[model samples]
Target: MKPVENAEGIQASLTLSYIQATVLKAKATLTVGILNGAPINIGIVGQADVVSDGKEGSAGLVHTDLLMQYDIQNDQFDAFLKATVKVIIAEAKVPIWLYFGANTPIPIGETAAEQKTRQSQNSNFDYYLYVGCPDGNGASRLGDAFSKVKVTIWKMDAGIVSGSLYGEAYFCIGSILPKFPPLPDEINKFLGYSTQSSNENSVINMINQGGSASGFMFGALVHGNINVDLAVIRAYAKATVGFDVALLHVTNPGSCQVGTSFGMNNWYAVGQVFAYFAMGVDLHIDVGLFSGNVTLAKLQVGAAIKAGLPNPTWMNGRIKIVGEALGGMVHVNKSMKFEIGEVCVPEMDPLASIKLIAEVGPGTDNVSVFAKPYVIFNLPMDNKPFKFNVMDKEGHETTRTFRFKVDHYTVKSEDNGYVGQGTKQFSADGYTMTLWSDEAFREKMKYTITIHCKAEELINNNWQKPAGKSEEEESIAFTTGIAPDTISERHVVISYPINGQNYFLKNEFKGKKSMVVVDQRNDKYFKLENDSNPIKKLTIIEADGGQVINTNFSVNGNDILFDLPGSLKNSTTYRMYFSIESSKTQEIKTTTELVDLEKTAGTGTVSMADVDFSTVSINTSVNILGASGSGNAIQSPTTTSASERGIRNKAKQEQSHRDAIDRFRKGETPVMTVINEGIENGTVDPTKIQDGTTAQGKEVAVYQPATGRIIYQMILEPVNLTPSPIKWLPLEVS
Candidate 1:
């Protein structure tokens, strides 16, 4: 391998086969070699360059014209490299060919000018090294003879056929970095390495320990972060290149996991903190022939993490179980029902972190109806489940009673809304509920949320059919009551005994009557067998004589004002009774009946139809104050006005009676007057007064129809009565 003067200031490819090379400061350390049947020490390969003065007449050459010849003084040889070769016959250590830069082929018997012309065009070569011989000589050639020796340069290309390119990715083991030192114990264990040289990872050890060993080959760089100017590249086949590329080597091996199952090898983030690569970038591969190249392929590694708890605000979530500490234990005291999938239960340790992992739909729409204040509730199938031990951070079980509260609530349905009057539609698909610890510092608290999914379709919908009974046990939702028609008249207003001692009365009619009210305001009801709000029972009694009427009457919404027949005597009271049939039951027995989907179209989600007449019937009375047949009408009390009926206040009237009695002794007894003037105003306090005293009186107001003016009111004579006790006998209870 000899080169003449033309090849100067040029870089060359140092082709080696079956070897490993490492990048070190923009240069390469070629390891492993076979030359002259002996391994060679590592040598440096520099980028093609030269040191020369550009002035002409220096060493009889200019920078552009040859640079130097073989002729040199002994002093000059000290500063400059020798361009001459000393080849002694039958001797070793004799200087042979002194070569530099790329090995330019000088054709056999070719003239210097012809070789120069070829070098200016395209002189092919593979590597350049000085071919040396020993200076110890058996015989030496004449200086002129050695100087006139011609050379034949055979190019190493045109003989190459096929080859491959390869790349290997590695990183620094735990304690030691990727360097020429003993590998770490962690890397040795991972690679099944035992002793120094008798291990499966010896190839890596050899490469690291023998860093300077020669004969190692390398590939051309396609893409890399190495600090070197990119080299000009060409395909080895030179056929047609750049189609669907079949890579023979890794392009970015640092970021890629190639042909390895390391991901499933139970690697934890323990010993190793960072990753580094021992990439064989720009490695040359061959199949006993030509060398092929590969780009810079990368390989990467990361842990497959087991996630934790989901966001607490999400409508649904799952509990992530890390280790199998609580093996096969099911502790589900709380539950969340999602709209999809099988009910999943997660078992975890008692003191695990309770963060939640939930996959929630983008935004949330809470559709929960609390039924009443303090009674928190939510819709079905709109929740996520998270599980954690109910133990304190110190490993003690905590039984703190916690309540779920509504952080957000609204009708999230896109399709439903209130229409007209009292009609609103529930147009949402479902609802949401976010349960949190009601305790202080609840944000720091963590509880295992167990998801309770309903297997029974009817149960999830709020109705549960009784075991033996055909009726279903239901849940009810009470709504805000509507406005009454008249101030004193409310059909849907009712009050009855709750705890047996005191009464729960409708506020509107609490003092107006004796536990009097019947809520018939809901003109609509569940499976109502009749017209709008039909009455199931009605009984009337003329209280003055205990005469009962036939069970027949018309019931309309809030018919609080009614009149008896005109034949009824003055001051006579009539008691009216109203009830539902159970043989006609009006009340909605169970709360669930209100929320059954089959019953309500999602709007009227509640029913209060159960009127339990088994305890006490609701009743009220009206008095026929004054009825005019056709004659003087016998001036009597009218239900129209309290002041006009002569039944002013029970206490005032009784005091007036006692005053009249005192005056009776002096012949000055006062008679009660039924005033006609106040009757037309209808300002009546209809409170009943049973005082056992009656004073006969008459009130007459003769009005002229043409002028519409009251003429006069005549107060007639008065008659007083006394109370008497009746004797009674008890019937036997048979």
Candidate 2:
């Protein structure tokens, strides 16, 4: 052994020699102080052997020792340095005391030379090895000294220990011994291994002192591929005025080689050191720390699925068009090539792609344990009701089965029904799917939808099951939202003239018939009908103060037909009213506007207007029959004188004309017939029957009004009418 002094203090080095094949274990204890003064005994163990480093053939002897330093007060060892070594070799089965440095502490203020020579005279102990090892003589015995001792002692096992002790030592000043091994907390202060450095004042201070405290794992002591920055260790060593003591005080399991056994064996020591030193932390051998598929952090899969529209929708029929959204959390294990390998969560067939929502931490190339993934699918339509069943890889039913039904209606018949009563299996290959419904859908009156899901079905992009309970659940049901008070459409009067004359009231059916001139458009009367029909009690009213006229009426293919009343003034405007009763009552009415006579030649196609025409008397006469004509006046007496005969003849002619006009006022088509007969027989004067033309293809009469106009009214029943053209059907998008 040789002792040397440096800027900090003095340190010494020594070696313990043993027969390689015979030695099983070894330990050493040293007691040193100033000669002839109090001595301090400090215990330490030898953990490494040079014999393991291919040095076993040095004259059949192997040397072993540990490189270590102890901080001793300079005043404690003044001049004559005294030390002794008691070694126990497993093969020897005995203890040998090897005297080295002089014993006892020098009195304060004594020089090294003075103390050394003074102690040499009084102390009998010398730097020599004693023979004949004692049996448990303790550390106090000096044994027998000889000029040269060739003692062979048996070695002993250090024995496996449950806990470990670790610490550092400074070179001189025995009282300034290295602090008890820094637990992980204190280590974190220098290494910043347990948490973020930005928040740790100790770590920040370390960095500010021109050193980084990152890249260290405080969970365990590691060698070889150690997770530590050599530069940081150097910086810490400089600041603490001492080197780090990574040594583990554990039993040395034999066969440890510096070149080949650095990893596993050293790791064993590291684990024990942590298990013993890290307060309150339960430590164990973590196999994952050395695996290729280690999980740096976990963005666990969830057993819950969330919907974009979690609430019931008013547009249930349009759900397919609206699309549904679903998703969960996922982690990209960077160590496994940015994939969550099968060892953790395996990828399944259904997931299409993944989007890294965000990085779980600051490093982009590191594990993204907090990322998110989403799935969106637009529903498809079919001719039958929809049913979706969810299952697992084992073919067992996992999630509940979803169901949907679509009800439809036809405009003409107002018939309503639903399609599909059977079940259909769903596929798990994708997030998108086809939803069954009636392709005949035009307008949906009502509908409902059910969604199914199992705790296991709600997996991550990797199809990994969540770390939660795999509970099975029933379907979630959602129905259509509240319907509006009334249904409406764009319907204009499909009859004659112009829209100026076809302006109907909103929310109802009503309008004027003036511009609808006789024998003009549609051959005679103004008419109106809509998508909703089989309308009843269709009647016309003179809004400008005129009674309902008696007119011919009929219905032909959704059209309400009637005669242009002769009594209706040419410029006068009128309103019409009607109703439809089918589960609900719909009263239709018309609005009055001046007849655009100039536009009477144009086809009327205007935005339909309607008003809620209140319920009117349903018992009103549907048709008003014209009254019979008065009988012809009697002829004057034939026996009268010439003056009396002329008077009688004129009186009879006047009475005959009046009877014909009376019939015409009653809207009787026979009135014109009687007039023509009078003219042919010379009983009615030619000039009395002013010229008037009847509608070319009509059997009705158009007689000249010498004085007053006639009133005409009639009603058409739809029971005998032809089928309507408008057909209402339910429709679904996509």
Candidate 3:
């Protein structure tokens, strides 16, 4: 071999000429340290062929040689170099005689010509490889011939190594020399085969920079009763680098075309290099979760039916709906949806499609070996993915697109089911994949996520076994939307009129009679009978400033009502409140209640199941308008005078008309009767009678200021009286 310089000009080389092919025996000519003497080159030149046996095939040059460089001042062949030409494996760490041969230090300032003359015309041992232009300019074996010189060597299975063995005087110069070589097949594979993709900063290369062989195997794993048919090996580097991967089939295992033998004997089926940036995701699957299917990530290996061969028939393919999230983790406990042939592997740059690798070790029920997959890195971005529509919770469906990251990432449910059991999965960061199946999808929302996966598993290995789900997880934060709306309707008193007056109290409810609001909008609010019921607030107050409300009120259909304890006072005012709420934004939150007042106050208390209140009351009295006739007065002067509070004499009655009014307003319908028993036959005067009905429906009393008399009355309705619209019939009036 010709001598070569490293990055630094330290140079060394060894030439071997093979004499026998069968045993790989050859003659090796070793040379070193020609740079030390400059024009006066100095080093060893063994003219005789050194017979070495290691000169071919894999372990080239299995031999060693010790060559020494001489320094006249140190005088005893101070520096030495030993080369172990090659080894069987790529790496070896045996100690060799790499330092100088002796610890002798020579004095500076000695030049080769000066040293030669100073040592007497003939020094012990001096040599020359070639004669230069003149006597002093020959390739001489004199270390001091030149200062600051370097020597380097190169060989197979090891890389370039350089350093120097140099010296100097007042001009103290240093030497550095490192030997260089053909790096092992394991080392410079990238420089040999790796390259950049079209995309910016993208690269494709092998992963086993420390391994001796090429090509990888993809296989499936089987558990007790399940066949883990899906798995993916991918390449992902730090940032922005993606891959355009392909499966190069090797008829025989070895480097593509390393040895000349490969070019002649090995057959390779080069596949299509797909779009880039695809990666493998860790989907944790297990048989314990019978509801969900397994994938290439973490899934329990199912038991196998067929154990041997290229791949077992037992490995099952699982169909799953995998989600593609941003670079961060996403919890997958969402509704499961599916679209065949859809793959969802989120990446820096997703691929246009995914392809699976072939089986290498075949599937085994009991995995005996650990998997060591080749993970390539620094790939480029890829082609356009298949786009389709996906539905959101808002009932809006939008189109999405995906690409292939791994060529062999196929997994389907038909082949990878859990004993025919199905499931809904819930996975979030910070949590393991838990399969939750609502055989009925009970509380789960029905949603579908589009999945894009490769047609097969992409790996080549002898072993595939189940991996437990990762407990190390991350949390996916979510903002809960508004709770499902549940509000039936709200009711308000639009206009409640009594005695020809209107009370438009929406939030306020005040009325003497039952308010029957007959409208088409009765049941406007949602009752949400299927959902949880919400609490409602109601407040009713009388003009006397007393609260009147009770839970005992009954709800008929959708109408809300509270039975009043007593009638509202004639001129008194009252207030009412109605409020209800369900969700944050779904309810009768704001309203108004206005009441028109007509009042005269007297307080009275009423009781109920949940409320107690005092209400206003009105009193009425009747008196004689004219003096009793003298003849009739003297004749009737037998009992008592009119000095008593009511009259000259009081007569008892079953119940007064005021009592009837109170009963009717208290959620009751009262009917009253009146009998005429005042002077029916003797001296009947028209002036002595009073009307029982008044302008406000009916009257309860009559008064005569001339005699300070009061005639009691019975509450009456229009229908109970004669045709004059609440006209009362009386015997006569004086």
Candidate 4:
């Protein structure tokens, strides 16, 4: 071995040699900087030998050193030295040490401190080896180096044995350094096999199964002729195996590849079995039939049935008249007359063509005849009531007023009895009778029966007694009196039984009969009876003078009768007197009567005697006395006959009487003097005097003739008196 210089360029010489196959130890010292500097030491191990350069005198004894250098900066030097030392010592070879006697070596033990100091010094110097051997192959020489040193071999077989090397010779060295044993034979079993062959076989099996192991069970079976590529097969196997591998890693179960290895031949079959298990479900399919046997065909059948029915002849359908036997026995010829209310069917299609038949019994002769079948139909009749009239062959001898009650007829079908109740009332004008029924009844055959009413029989059956009276009568009676002014042509003579006398009186008088005079002053009037002296006397003086004037007058012996006049004044006083002479007694009978009468009785009279003086009466003795300024005298002698004294007494005492009367007189004058000259002879007539007089523009003042009050009496009547032989006196006046 040689010492090298430090970084300061200092150099020193040192020698290292091995003497034999024993340990040769040497030490070299050097100072290094810093108190804690790393120390390094190196050892060289070799053998001592003889060497020649090919001359006889040149053969000499020499030593070869197996050097180890420690340079901390050079990993190659450190590794080579470490490895060489391990190999030499495993062989029990020798080694030489240098640099062992330093202060650093004493603190860390001589061998460990020397190695640290050399490592520090060699940081700048490189280490090298020198061999001195006599053989070209280095093994024997390497063996001698080991024999001289006392070190044993750390590991054997570190170098190549034989043949060309491949792969990891450095790792072999590392193995020997650690003395690790060889790998087991079980681990190396696949050491030299090819992986491509295994992958190719897997691809071939996948292809034989047609790329789908479950295809056969799915009915997609392929023959062995189907092929697949090895790469695809391998990829598929890897995906499957890797998936299971991942499962195992997470689950930490047994190896996943165990099933693959044991079941490789049956893999396709297993998949097929699983597929079949999935496919074992039930399935179904459906189909429908299309034969023409539905309801539409049945409808066509019904139409065909309708088509085969019989056809009608007239009016869109056949007409079969039907009639029903009513009250009378009816005789119907089988061929001529048909029954009403019978189900004739009217020759409709597909139905029977039979006509409704009807018959009458043996007693049905010479009467109204009708007949009907059991079933009646409104369909053939169109819901109209059936009507038929039976007549003789000549059509002249019809039944006497036989009326069919067609309103009571009904159309019935089959055994539905009656179609409905017949309409009770006939149509207006007594023509047709209609029956109402439901639509169901109209759809069937119907029979109708009509009742007949005989006019004569109805008249007899419904006869009634007559009623009695109509009204009542009434009578009335009324009465009224006749007016006094009515003429005598004919009068309404009122006859009433009074005081047991059946006195009849003519209300008026005519011709040879005396005029009926109503002497109202005497209340005596004449009434005519049925005898020759029908004129009777009535005394009704209770009437005014105006009511008595112009009244009809008549006379009878004693029974005086007259109607009271209506124009009598309401309040009046009247006096009446009658004078009559009795021939046998030679005496005058005189009497007076008074009446306080109202004016309503137009012809009332008071009677002095019982005789009616309605015809004639005497008013005698008019006396004239005095005037206001003249001494005119109209006086009569007291000794003369009461009837004849009018003129005699007037001449005898004329002047003296004038003087005597004028002394007692006042106002007004008398223009005339007259007397009843026939009063003494009993033959005075009142009608001889003027009926009425009017004053001729002269006012003769006199006292009131009725009231004795001074008044102007217009002396309208001029009177003259003749003197007589019985001592006449001068007329007195004033």
Count clashes in each candidate, considering only residues at least 3 apart in sequence or on different chains: 71, 57, 116, 110
lDDT of 4 by residue, 598-708 (tens): 222222222322222221011113223323323233332334432233223224334434443443363233322234352233222323322222242222322223323
The per-residue C-alpha lDDT of model 4 at residue 298 equals: 7
286-339 per-residue lDDT for model 3 (tens digits): 456353432233211111111111110111121222233333344232222222
TM-score of candidate 2 relative to the true fold: 0.17
lDDT (C-alpha) at residue 613 in model 1: 17
Mind giving the per-residue lDDT tens digits that candidate 2 earns over 142-211?
Answer: 2222121122223222332122222221211111111122333433332223332111122111111211
The superposed Cα distance between candidate 1 and the true structure at residue 39, in angstroms, equals 94
In TM-score terms, candidate 4 sits at 0.11
Better of 1 and 3 by TM-score: 1
TM per candidate comes to 0.18, 0.17, 0.14, 0.11
Worst 10 residues of 1 by lDDT: 238-247
Q: Whole-model lDDT, candidate 4? A: 0.23
Q: Where does candidate 2 stray beyond 4 Å?
A: 1-347, 351-535, 550-568, 579-734
Candidate with better lDDT, 1 vs 4 = 1
> What range of 10 consecutive residues in model 4 has the weakest lDDT sum?
238-247
lDDT of 3 at 717: 26
